[model samples]
Each structure stands twice: as C-alpha cells, then as structure tokens.
Target: MGRRAIVLLVALILAGLAAWAVWNFLDGVRSEAEAEQVQVTVYRAAEPIAEGAEGGILLSGQELIVESTEEQVDLPDDAITTQEELNSVLTGRVAAGPISANAILTRSQWTEVTIDVTPLAELIPSGKQAITIGMDNIGGVNGFVEAGDRVNLIVTLDIAADVIPADFPTLPDQETGGEGATGEAETITVTYTRYVLQGLPVLAVGRNVRLDEDAPTVIDVEPDPTTDPGIEGEPTEEETGNETVFTLEVTPEEAERLAFAFENGSMWMTLVPEDFVEVETSGVIIDTLFGGNLLDDIFQN
Candidate 1:
C-alpha cells in the first residue's frame, strides 16, 4: 500500500471507533432511562374506606402523596399519577368494595365512571339525546311543570305574504298592463302557530335540576305566597313569574328538528297530565281550529 493509502486507512479506523463509542454511549443511556427515578403521586388510604363513598374522597394530600420512585417501579394498576386523572375520574367514583386502611388505591379497586356522563344519564333512553330550551313563564306551564313531567312543544311563526322580486332579473313594463304580479306588490302578514313536538319528558326545569341528581333539588322553581321561596314574601321583580329553562329527552332525529325550530321561532310548552293517554293526532293548526264548526259561536265549543 502507498503512504497515502495507509494514512486514509488509519483515519477510517479512527472514525469507525468514534462512531462505535457514540453508539455504545447512547445504548447505555437508553438502558437506564426506565430505571431513572421520577417523582409521581400515588394514593394511600388514610382511613377505613367507606362502603360507597368515592375513592377520591380518601385522597387528601395528607393521605396521598408524591414520592420519588423508579420509572420502572411496580405500580399498582389503580395508581393515580396526576391530580386531573384523580379528580376528573376517580374522585366521583364509588368503590367496588371496602379498602383497608393504609392500602394503596389502584385502578382495580374502584368502579370506573365514564367521563362526562351525567349522574342521571341512566334516565335517558337509549338512541335519544338530552337538549335544553329557553322558555318564558307561560311556556314553562306557569312553573307547574316539574322535571319529570311530560310536555308538548309548539312554535309560533309570523309569515308575511310579501311581493318579492322575480327569481330572474326583470323590470316593470308599462306597455304590458304595468301591474305587478297579482296586482300591486304588498305583504299580507299572518300569525300562525302549530305543535312541533309532543310527549317529551322534562329532564330539567330552570337552573334547579342542572346537576342531574336523583332527587329533586331543594331549589324551588315556582313562587309560593306563604314561603320564602317567593323571594322574601313578595318575589323580586325579576323572579316573579320569570323565565325558566327546560331540558328534555328527545330522539336524536327529533333533537335536530327541535333545535332548528328553537332557533327559527318562538316555542311554547304545554304540560300533559300523567294519567291521560295521548292518541296520535294530526297536530292542531290555525286552519283546523274551527274544524266543521266554522260558523259556531266562540263559547259553544
């Protein structure tokens, strides 16, 4: 080999050794990565676990704590490492069984709760959706409708028969009668209302049942003449026969229609008697209000 060849060969051998050293160093660091200590919070029982209380209730800092442990430590499956995981999840969940004092809480110890599921989710029928609608005093059954009551929803629309421009560009022609379509353009406004949805179970009324707890909340929805529920005997101007919001259970398809109706027009609620059964009726409209008795007296029924 020439001298130049020998120099090149030596340089190549050094570069190979340098590359091997770097590779070996990284391999060693990777091997120790899991063995490195990390600070994490783990649950510890402070007292005897309640029969049905949430697992998180036992997780005060005094009871649970953050400690340094190897990343590869043998953690129980129920181990909670973060506050959000604990609060958002484990906090409201009931224990599946009793937990002994000083026992570490693990994922396996408590019943799992679906995230964002309401406490009253059990009441919602499958294939249905829960939606809220805004209502004034009259639309809310005058504060008589409770959360579990059934109601019918109606919408009132003011349609105006207006003379709009033709679909395509056009101009008035005096030579051809000089009159707008169907005489001079004018709007004939009409007030009409119709039932939109029926047999809807009231899921919530006003702000009282927002939490979806099993029992009706202590927050009184209606005014009482003799009690403090009416805001110090005489209700405040705002609280007397004030507006209430209602949440109802509806089929997914009906939810879309109801949402569209709510946005497009005003809604009224009609409370239905629990004992009364409803037969299918082609909902009432202004055109049918007189039926066959168009000329009958108003009070003749």
Candidate 2:
C-alpha cells in the first residue's frame, strides 16, 4: 500500500468512531429525559371511600389532592386524567363497590349509569298506540300541550257537494244564502268543525316527558331572551322549546280514525282541566258560527 493511502484509511476509521460515539451520547440523554418520572394528578380519597359514593366527586379545595408516585407508574387505561374530565364524565356515578382511602380511582369502581335518556316508547302503556299529530301555534294551544295532560280533539273539514257523506250534515251560509235559482248556480262549500275525541291523554310533546303536577299553567310565553334563539336543536321543553308536535295515546280504531281526519282536514286541540270533564254538544257547522243560539252569546255580553 502507498504511504498516503494508509494514512487516509486510518483517518477514516477514527472519524467513523467519533461520529458513532456522539450519536450514542445524544440517544442516551434523550432516553434519560423520557425515563424521568412524571407527576399525574388523580383523585384520591382523603377519608375512607364508602360504597355508593360518587366515583368522580369533586374535592373541596382543601381536600388532599394526590399525585402519582415518584416511582414510574403503569396506570390503567381507565385512570382519570383531570378533575374536570372526572367531573364531567363520572359525576353522580356512584361507586359500584367500596374503594380504600389513598387508593387510585379506577373505572371498575364506579357503576355506569345513563341519565336523561328515557325513550318515548316507554311512555305508552300496553294495548294502546301512540299517534303523533303535527300542529302550529293555533292548533297546539300555543305550546301548552304537555305529556300527561288531557286534550279535546277537534276536526275542521271541508265538505264539497260532490263527495259529501250521507251521515254528515251541512248547514247553509247565512251571509251568502246563495242565488237560490240563479242562472249561474253557486256551489256553496260548507265548513264543519267537530269536537270528535274528548279527554284524550297526551303522551308527549316533541321529546319532552310529562310536566310535574305542580308545573304552572302555560300562557303565551315569549322566548327567553337569554336563550340564544340562533342556536338550534330540539329546544328544552317548556324551558326553551317551541313544541310543534304532540303524541296521543289511542285505541287502534281511534288511531285509524284520527289518522284519517289528520290527512283529510285540519285538527286542533284544546287543553282541558286535569280533571277532564266532557261537555255535551253536537259538532259545530257553518250555521253554528252565527245561525245557532251562539249569536245570543255575543249579544248578551
């Protein structure tokens, strides 16, 4: 070998060794930093953790908040990370079994319970079908219809001379008594509104359950100013909800009849007293608007 070639080979070996040593040193420093133990906050009982206590109950500011051991910890995946996370997902979840004081909390210690998830089907009793009817301000009693309340169902139907039912009666319009025998025969359309189903129980309004018995009567209430009207979803029933539909419990036959009336005509409901009392009356017709003794009701007052 040439003298210069041997020197170059020796230089190359030394440089390679130095580079490998520097890389190894950096890797060791990184591992040491990572291996350094980290302190994680966990909820530890200041006193004996009794059975049935909340798994994620908030600690008083002075409570003995705890940190993970100085020794490296292999915490279970279910270990709660923050007080806020514990409060939100674990609050009110009672301890399924007892836990010892100063012991780290685990998901297994608490019972999983679901809140505010009652389904509409559960509200309907056996042998009855739930029928939902759509309504607006006029038909829905201005958002007064609530679950467990009784309502009187009324139907307003248009009867054309061509398809009028034989059983259904019609009355003449007083104002437009019609060209009795005029050259151009005027077809008089009659509108009859019948109070069909009395004291039907309301099962639900939108997604809300029944109101408390002591809940105050609802009048026409303006939307809460604090409630962001811009925000949208199902509104909180009675709190912020503008209810647009109501479900009623009815027999199969009654449901079929109600569905027919809903498809054919406009249906309305009047909320009756909790003690639903039926009123005696035949259905109202065009004549009843003014032709009946109803005129006396207006004149008398």
Candidate 3:
C-alpha cells in the first residue's frame, strides 16, 4: 500500500508541474504576439481617393491593425493614425510620408494644385504709384518708366493751327489773329475758333513720380539671355528684343490699356525730358525707320 500510494502522489505532482509550465509558455507566446502587433496610422482622403493625387492637399488619418500576420487582428472604427502614425503600416516603416497632410498628398495626382500669392508677383500692381501712358520720353517706350523714375507723358492731339517760322514766328497772339493764315513756323498756334476733336491739352504731364519698386512687373518675362546686344533694325542674330518690360504704377484697368498699347504701337523710352509741346505728331514716322534723321530735313526745310 505504501509503495503504490507514493508512486501515485509523485505522478500527480509531476502532472501539475507540467501543466503550469505549459500555461506559462502559452502566456509568454500570447504576450509576445500581442506586442508584435504594432498599432500604425495611415491617411485616407476625406473623399474616396485615387492613387497619385496632386501634391499639397489636406488628408485625414485612420488607425490600422498590423503584425507579422500571425496573431488575431483588430481594426476598430475609432483607430487613430496620422501620416506619422501609419507610416509603418502603410509604407512598412514609421515616418515614411511627409509629416504634414498637404505634403504627403502633393505627389498624388488626385490632389489639387495650389498657387501661392508669392509667385504671381508680375500680374499685380502696387498702389499710389505713377505709371507712364502714351508717347513716352524713353524713346517712345512706355512701360519701362518704372514707379519711381521721373517721366514725361506726351500725348498727341489733332488741332488746326497757323504754322509759323521763327523768323516770322506766329506770335502766340498773332497766330490766333487772322483766318487762312499759312506760314512755316517753328511754333504753331491752334486757334480757339478751331473745333478740336480731342481738345487742346492732348498730353497729361507728370514729373519726378516715385515708383513702387516692389510692384510686380508685367512684361515679357524671359530667362536671362547668354548673348550680346544685337544691332538695331537688323533684328538680333539669334534672339531679337521681343519682350518689353514696362515698369509702371497703374490701375488694373490702366494696366490692361498699357499692355494693349505695347502690343499695338511703336514705343520707345528716352531719359531726357523735353519741352517741345508744339511738335507735330503727323509726318513724324521717325520711329518706324529705326533712328534716321529724315525728319530733321523736313524741319530744316
């Protein structure tokens, strides 16, 4: 009886020890599996998203269940993940995508492109700046007259007047004296009796106006050229002077007009300010010939 009882008791003790060992091993395995299942975050567009969304857009995050594909997985509705949160789950590493939502979405074609105000410097104009309009002293160039540079604006008007020469110059008073008076004068006087279509003061003149240099320039925006200056009238050997940079302070509406003028007319810029108000606008095709003194002959004669 003693031997049988002792053997049975020993067997029972060994059985209990073995069961405990199995339980401990199982517990460790479960713990390690749980730990291996890392919590990761991934971003999902608020709307259904396609791959290649355009760069720089907002995105929302969703939490995900991830592990070695061995343990029980749980992806709950409330799982929280950010670009950083889901990097490991989505891209196989933590912090893979940009930290910001916009940056992460920038590469995606689906993302909308955003244009910042900083890049549109040329299309906009500054306030309270003086811009040159009409025939400019800058050799007839208009837009180059920047916001601060002193510029004289010359406008042409059609007025019937008595042409007088300096020798028999129509004195300001005498030119208006009689009708049908025809004389060659350096100065011509428009009679008040004449009906002027546009009126007497054809030019609105401004001097020494300050330019808002910070104003955006709207002209032909070309990359810096590597060539030397080309000869006038001959057109450049390679790249001719195609674009004219007109720097001026003008209202948005006026800017439209200036742009139109640059496209249509022969414009020039002159550094010198002239007081030749009585100059004739007609017969002065001097601008077309590209700097010839032909008009000088007409004036001299």
Q: For model 1, how does the per-residue alpha-carbon lDDT over 242-269 read when each residue is reduced to its tens digit?
A: 5477889899888998988888788988
76 Cα displacement, candidate 1 (Å): 45
Summarize candidate 3's per-residue lDDT along 216-249 as a digit string, tens digits.
Answer: 6533222112111222245442243222333354
Clashes of 1: 2
Best lDDT among the predictions, by candidate number: 2
RMSD over all Cα atoms, model 1? 24.0
How many residue pairs clash (N, CA or C atoms closer than 3 angstroms) in each of the candidate models, in the order given? Answer: 2, 0, 37
**Distance from true position, residue 145, model 2, in Å?**
1.9
Model 1 lDDT, residue 61, Cα: 27
Candidate 3 scores a C-alpha RMSD against the true structure in Å of 15.6
What is each predicted model's overall lDDT from 0 to 1? 0.66, 0.69, 0.37
Candidate 2's residue-wise lDDT over 1-301, tens digit each?
A: 9999999999999999999999999999988987786666666655565565544443422353465542326666677667676665556576665566677766677766545444667667799989888988778888877788889889889877654344334455568984333233345677888887888888888876664445455432232222223335554555644587888889899898898898889988898997768887777775587656666777888
Please give the lDDT score at residue 66 for candidate 2: 60
- Can you list the residue pairs that collide in candidate 1? 78-106, 78-107
User: Better model by lDDT, 1 or 3?
Assistant: 1
TM-score of each: 0.40, 0.48, 0.26
